[model samples]
Target: MKVNCPTCQSEVEWSAESPFRPFCSKRCQLIDLGEWAAEEKRIPAQATQEELERALPDIEEIEAMLAQQGDSFFRDH
Candidate 1:
């Protein structure tokens, strides 16, 4: 079997003889590692509940915002 290297798109044999099955050479493997380390490569994911909560405005901030808006914010029409 053969597979293309994730970094260089070079063909690599998928076997025990091929140390880096998904990468053509050590250079290609290192390049892919560097991309990941630099945050250039990322897996799509949803924010965790804790992360979402942390991003939301706290009670104090919400109150401050409401105070800044004043009574008109509550007035209908």
Candidate 2:
């Protein structure tokens, strides 16, 4: 089967042989990655404040945990 590459719009073979199945080549794949990294492409969604709060740790909690863990927490594990 063949499908259009999301990055370059080139036809790509959807097979195990094609390492970048959804993209034509590594360049195209990287281009797509760059776009996502740069926030040029975004997944459409509407998140509530409650959802956002639940998804992220509080800054105070993070600071307290880091203070308790100390520098060794990052170096050792």
Candidate number achieving the greatest TM-score relative to the actual structure = 2
Error of 1 at 51 (Å): 39
Q: What is the C-alpha lDDT of each candidate?
A: 0.49, 0.51
Query: How much is the lDDT of residue 8 in candidate 2?
Result: 51
Candidate 2 lDDT over residue span 1-77, tens digit each: 99987755668999987787687765454444443333533322332334434433343444455457563522212
Q: For candidate 2, what's the RMSD?
A: 14.4
| Candidate 1 residue pairs that clash | none
Off by over 4 Å in 1: 38-77
